[model samples]
Target chain A: MTSRERAEGPGDGIPGRAEGTGDGTPGRGERADAGVPERGERADVGVPGRAPVIERRLHPVTPLRRAWAPLAVLAGWAVHDPNAAQEQLARLTDTMLLLGIAVLVPAAGLYGFLSWWFTHYAVTDTELRIRTGLLFRRTAHIRLERVQAVDVSRPLLARVAGVAKLRIDVVGTDDKDELAFLSEREARALRAELLARAAGFAPETAREVGEAPAHVLLRVPPRELARSLVLTGATWGSLCAALVVPTLLWLFTENVWTVLVTALPLLGTAGASSVGRFVTEFDWTVSESPDGLRIDRGLLDRAHETVPPGRVQTVRIVEPLLWRWRGWVRVELDVAGSDNSVLVPVAPRAVAEAVLARVLPGASVPAGLSPVPRRARWCVPVWWRGHRLAVTGPVFAARSGLLCRRLSLVPHAKVQSVRLTQGPWERRWGLADVHVDTGAGKTVTARLRDAGEAGRLLAEQAERSRTGRRDAPPDRWMTAR
Target chain B: METGSLDGTGAPADQPVWRRLEPGLLRVRRLLLAVWAGVFAVAAGLLPGLFAGPAWAACALLPLVCAATCWRLLERNWRSWRYAERADDLLISRGVLWREETVVPYGRMQLVEVTSGPLERRFGLATVQLHTAAAATDATIPGLDPAEAERLRDRLTELGEARSAGL
Candidate 1:
């Protein structure tokens, strides 16, 4: 499944080898001159130092897959208004209707085909270069070391077509580059290749280690996931709104249809979100691999996400109100460059802690967090007991919220800044909140602490972050090994 | 001077040397507030005067009251803005009603930008912004002398490169 051997198939082009003199070309002469020490390992795997550059276009079925949505809409529009369709047909004659279909179908196909043809991606020795766009030739060369994670998502339409989309998340960038509509096999192979390279392995050894089978750690049952989704605050809030708004409207307007209309949208949104979450997290499974923790989920879309080591900025464990009775909680990760942060959609507390230990290496959610000062009760009358903080050797953990208890942990090495904030009321009470910021855009805040304690925490956390970063492991994990 | 040391050394000499924003910023803020107040006063006076009656022109006094209140508050807000340069991190404390103190370590600094708008340039003031990997660290020191702003930018950049760590 190595990219070099797979590129020999039809429709795949090795422009680097064909042209023989392009930029960053891994030619035989250069491979010999640039003698990396891993050459012997490459020979053991039957592959030499640097593999030939693998460059290929998107799947040929991409055009039809891309045009299907608009085609479906057109057909629906024509069937929806039969009178308008007949009137238009009568005005233009049956030949004109046929002519319009002939022109539109091919036009859409041609545009899709042209865009697909223009797009090409190449995996080089140092970087993965994606050259896209027609009129504006935009090329993104993401360095291999900066590649954070690779996600493969299969939308329903693309899944039916037996193709998938690959999203590459790079460090320090907000937008992810995607290669849409590749054969499922090809996408998986490409993803493994990218991950292996990002882990600092030579192409030959990358194939050997990348293809190693991962151990399945945990899988959430479909019933448990649906139960957890229903138990969320959002679901309960929307359910209450759906019932109350219609009742209030019925009292005022006294119109059944008006009440029905208002209630339908509210009920529909709540139902759709619940069903969407269930579908997206149906077969949620977390696996432990040498590269990192791999999450494979989805009933319909089927997304495979990898959270590489050192990329997670923070971890959040949420125990919703109802889930507390069932002793289930959801673990979310603030991973750099990836938005799908759910480590475990729903798991027991013990299971979640095990998974957390795997992802963060040495960090865990502390059981005994120091509660806020008693004076804080003036500000948060009810929830002051829930707000607590703990500073451990590897991570800083903060707990907040009474109804839905949230425990957020930020690794000391990953802390970006520390802040202390005091409001007017807090000033009177001599209380402040300490916030620990990370690159993942989540802050772990210790709320309603003594002003002096907050100041000391802020200063100590800064110093800990400095020493933590100094003692942290190297970014390139495989190279360090 | 705040007598507490942010370094946790508990030494008086180690206490942070807090520096205040330039006094010129007060004048600049006052002038800008006056300009907005004038515009609002005209709009309030003319719009209602034309629509309702000439008697509604008295509504223009509302903006004057608000502007005067803000004028007095601006002085305290300006006085509240102060920053301290520590051995390892930069501390910025500001806000009148809500006191916010931010500590940005030198190793975490990604980019330091010096910007001066038209009005700020006219008043000989520049703003220095420090960016880290985290977006929540909104650390900005506004209303500094141009030379000091430049010096800060250069020093921060040099320190950032020397101590930069991977995110």
Candidate 2:
């Protein structure tokens, strides 16, 4: 499934049209030349004032880029097995590698080309429609109003080719319809236009920035990223990797425990993952835009997230064991569209609190909320100080965790369901867990000592959810105060 | 530890006591188990050709032993299935071992359905299903009188409309 969106506006008209001409340039070196709508093209829109929904194909470079993997595989097989290259073509089995490459290379290229050619997307006045499928053709229609966010991203190859990917996140669907391999310029313009339109704006009079003006909230430079890596236990991964070298030496030089062998791989894998996280999320920048928060991160593959107002369903303030020593916290939002949104990847407690106040005005952390009952102590003895929940603000908040202090907030309006569950042990302790769920399956549960509290929370959250569903404005973007 | 009331109404003084399902449900459970035992009996009849006499005999008597266990568990299950209509929400508590009490608010109810299967219809019984936004919260009150099921559906639907906040 290739996801590419040229949601960027090339000045509101035919975005992918080459600047000077609609030349069918040679398919090999595919570089999209974004264009302003020609007067004739604008007239062709026929819808007097509205921008025409042009059914545009993905940038041709998409196929070539996608085909790289298979081509690389062919090259790898030939290089790795040099004997196969030197072998005489006496039999079909002897020439197996040659036959494999001949079949796979062309097949891979064809697949990529067909995939790029078959996928076409267009945005009407109210709906964004995509028609894709080489064999099993499928067409999806997403109402503009239901669109959550449109993110623009470019990986290393796409960046080199001046192409970007556009992902349109919607409600209640796991599938994020994407338009991959649009010209970077066209993708940006499309993102601006489509996002503006999604936020209830006219195509021509698009806010461009959507109203959440560009105010940098957080930026992680190389030094800060290194610091966060240490703070986030990524350094432990580094230590694990470092230990592997000595462990390897010990295995050959001295008697080693069987436990050490298994632990080595586990530690090394964990360490590598942290290193990977640090590398990709190296240059981080979180800023406020006209309509929502903008997150731009990645090293080789720069990614951009345009989270519109109210896209977030919940906010979690997580403090790792090490971070607790220094009183630092990382803020993440549970949004419907994206998997997880890190509002503040890592910040001091005060800064995190200040940010929570700015973005989610009435949200409160566990410490700010009511404490769990004394009897409920058994449920969370280690983090009794944080095992708490409250429903005084515009949302319900829960706090728990021992090694990591996690405070989660679920606004009343977006709540989909409330369930009160009790395991045998929890029941014995006269405790119950209240799960506050959203449609996207984001559930926040609070373990309450008082069964009554859990019940009350369930009832109250249900009411809150009902009221919230009634045209509740996504979120109050702090444009002014 | 005396916890909070089911619906946050401070344990209504006149809160309706949980009502049990129709006795026919026990019969339904037994009948289903009998069907399974019948299949097992056929397997047991054929087992002597492959297994030892003792193993074959044990398999042959499996249906009788299985029927008794089903009788006891089904009774316990039927005994445990109870529901209460509170002022603000409907409460259901069930389970042979791990007891669960689910409190669904009237306002959060999106749909209520009345349905009956062949056996249930034969027993003049139906089920009232309540659907909330969360699939977990979607609940079913089984083995009700057809009339009672219809009445509950109408009442719940009415209350749902009056109390519903949103999807």
Candidate 3:
């Protein structure tokens, strides 16, 4: 529906909360209620009557960044323009460029200015409400309880301008409710307050909007980044890009400068960005706070991600062929909100295990996991690669991979489905594979290859899944027990 | 119906009663494939800068090769397609050379959708899709009688609820 036809009257259903007003003001009694939770039990009291109350604008400097593209295009033309010989022709080109600049300046400037001017957002006790439109008004309301994660990011320009973008992702869908272009202070405050409130409850006077120091768990130093750069396969991408294109172009043009001139831009942009990203996340650190695990990493576009305890659906531990030799692996958490957030980019096995233990209390692969049936040797020749699985009372664990060892873990209460698949080769070998599905679509926690074991596992997992679904907490996937 | 051992690592456990898809599904698939081959033949034979081209002979042979391949594949695929419902899960096996068998548990099913396109409607066939939280667990049974598809959907939905009591 178009809000243009009939303006969507703001928050008529909100009890005692003001509408989506342009100014950042809560309802009359909301000030007493709007005190967002910071440190203590005060969050619970402020949550009940909460309605997205404060309406505010994005960063005022957004116009500069938004209008910069047209300016950059003009500069590129000035440097690259090859036809500037005749005075009359040059004047004609100059006039057109001048006219283009004139039209573009106001067009981009006004567009950015108008969009920022029209956008508005407020924090309700139970929801985050946003109304933004240049011509046709659109409003979005995100339920506080459903706000699984809130990340505050400051990119290169935003960092310089001291502004940040706040992204709030909910469960089930890929949609993220965003409120961008806020001052650093505003972004941090909104994130802490919103996360506190969304963690199922918020106190009336709970005051930290956090930013409190956390107990440091792990850190990635510059040395490790250098090591990772040399070890990680992504470096090959840069190698291919730098060499392959220039070589092909040399064959065609036969002029070495032509190759360098043509390929320089590609190399400069790709190499710089990738290197920047690597450096940005160079000094990575995982720490603990009252809210949960607070992650601080990144260089150019620095990101602060908060993952609450028990919020993860599954965890995947992978070791690349090279990393395996060094006994290193990466740990990623599959929270319902965003895609797999790397818990650790790369770490020693002991370090990863320690972090995993602390984040997931009472979680460990049960000893003496049942081995895959004997004939599985044919299906997976790397039998000695530690292809093992086990289902204890709380978690299900599967370990596999020859060059790279991977261990996938899912809690019993989180099992979504159990599947049994048999390929023609496996059928010929009288074998089949059983896989268990979870919230994270790409990561399978259990994959047991066997014929008889597949059937037994199918029946067993079916029962386990049924029980998990039956007793699952009423509140999404976050319930601890 | 064929029975097989359910022992671990080698053969499957107790066999299931196999049920084939609607016989008309084979005819439907053959007709669709024939039309595709016919299109290739007509395009090569009719459309041209000139019909007397170097590719003219090869183009004429395309339809025969395609039709033959289609016939063999369709027949083999028809024979390969079979499904069985166990006590708590459903098993489907298909593919001629790279055969695959998928077993879906009833308890984990989140949605059961019954759909039929215009062509299937004309042929009195429908498809039923069972969805679970895991994409791997999702399964589709096609070319069922409309009435049969409805019955299975209802049964699965009811069983799904009964089994999905936790979380």
Candidate 4:
């Protein structure tokens, strides 16, 4: 009748649950094994039922976390110009801080304790409930069946303390209500348990872990990283000047020691940021597990994100002008999760094509699937050409990839709005900017060097969009109007 | 949903013989903006003395400051003026430098709102904002007489709901 017996049931292939405390009643520890439902006659019914016990655990951010703040205050006192006794008093203050670490720390601990007390969460077999607040409490219950993905994450400090946060995303749940964190071991156990339980809900039986496709790991070489650094500088040159100029002015008023203490960190951060961005921004890997793909990267702390195939809405291939020569491309996927899109920051254009083909194979391109005037094509001409040309047929045409180029075919159904805009120089040169919105969530646009062509493109796309909506059910008021 | 030559201007074919700009209405708006500009100029001239430290700076900035207020009032008057009804949608163009033309299809309109501010009421004018599902695309026609604003609201409401209902 326990979770162990349920795992042993023929319907599920997951490992048996750990034993609960020897008492008949489920203990706090048993609640740690909260989601593993016992074997039941309902196993054939395929409904995930609850485990007998649940536990409440505090977040690991305790009073001991504030040890540095008071130490900082003592450090400030030590540097102040004062008599010998006064200076000694400052030194004595450090010892006092250490002694009061018992009482003072717990006083600060009260804030964290209240925060933990105010937060409450429970994960049963069927659903997860979180309730927290000081004045106006909020309670959110998410059905486990609707969960799209669960992200378990921890910063370096939290990892040292062996605790991590859990963020579970469901299709329709609001952003704030979908996240909860448990300790590191507990989070892993909970994730495994939840994934295992979700497996029972699958219409087909569960397969072994390695049954999924092998993951493709791709890393950008150091040369490519250096190139990315140069590109990042070009893109953010103005922004860098804005931050550095102010700090340089501030350094003059400070003492030599003070300037060194502050400016060193600032300089170090800038250097690290440039290097980290180069290291992390474009290094991409795609690994497939039974659950879904795990995409991991970052400059400081690594992020491992799992995206199930069922939640994917659209796939986009992006190619910016700077990376064009290198044949580098980036791929992002729109999925139903807390973060709307998954960024594959950097990939070789060739590698990206293979990945996109695997994830979204034969998905009809939105632009090319329609007839003329129903789809739009946007084009920017080369320098050698006299003018840019944008042509819209019953097809949507777009360029894809970051470094190299590939043509993207978006269909008419995806086109939302068409716009034509021209500025002073553009008008002088008879050029216009054209943008098209697609149902795929954001604006996809192309600028044409020629105004006349831009107008035609706009008109054709607008016409296509109108025709696509013509078959929609008529409103009741049309006759009366 | 189709982009056309409507441009929020009434169809050139449907103009009424007497629908030209009313001289009385135009004079009233111009007078209001003129008075507003005078009041802003006076306030700008006086504010510098209220603060300390080389108060000449505020005095020097007053005319440039007054220019902004004058321009804003004049621009509002310009944008609030409207001139259009076409076959499919009601066209309204408003705004000063950043002129905007909005088309509200009789079928797409959810409701018509008629509102009057203190200044508008004193001028015997009211503003009407037509509501639609595409929130950003709503049409607002301002600077109409109370009588005409009400009439337009009713006409738009009747046409909108009827078109919405497919009656």
Model with the higher DockQ, candidate 1 or 3: 1
The candidates' DockQ values read: 0.32, 0.20, 0.20, 0.06
Model 1: residues >4 Å from true position, as ranges? Answer: A1-52, A72-92, A171-176, A207-209, A230-261, B1-15, B38-62
Candidate topping TM-score: 1
lDDT of 2 by residue, B1-167 (tens): 22224444466633656788888877877788888888887778667736766556566677768777777988998898888776556778777666566667666665567778887788777887776545556478888888777766766665555555433
Q: List per-candidate RMSD values in Å.
A: 8.6, 9.2, 8.6, 13.1
- What is the C-alpha local distance difference test score of each model? 0.79, 0.67, 0.66, 0.51
**Relative to the unseen true structure, what is the C-alpha lDDT of residue A63 in candidate 1, on a scale of 0 to 100?**
69
Candidate 1 residue-wise lDDT, A350-419, digit = tens:
9999999988887877878998888788999988989989999999999989988999998899998999
Model 4, range A1-481, lDDT digits (tens) per residue?
0011110122111111121122222332323333434421111112235333343444546333445687787677755654764756667666686887778767766866675666665555545656566566666665554455667666566667766667676644555553434566666666655554453433222212213344655555556666655665343554465467556756666556655666566655676657656545534456766556666665445455665543343456666667767777667765444473645566677787666655543443333321212111323223212212223433455543323443443444334335555654455556555555443334444543356666666555655644533443221111121
Docking class of 3: incorrect
Q: Taking the tens digit of each residue's C-alpha lDDT, what string does model 2 give over A384-441?
A: 6667777764778888786777888877766755767777777777777788766445
Better of 1 and 4 by DockQ: 1
Q: Can you list the residue pairs that collide in candidate 1?
A: none
Task: Please state the CAPRI-style docking class of candidate 2.
Answer: incorrect
- Order of the predicted models by DockQ, top scorer first: 1, 3, 2, 4
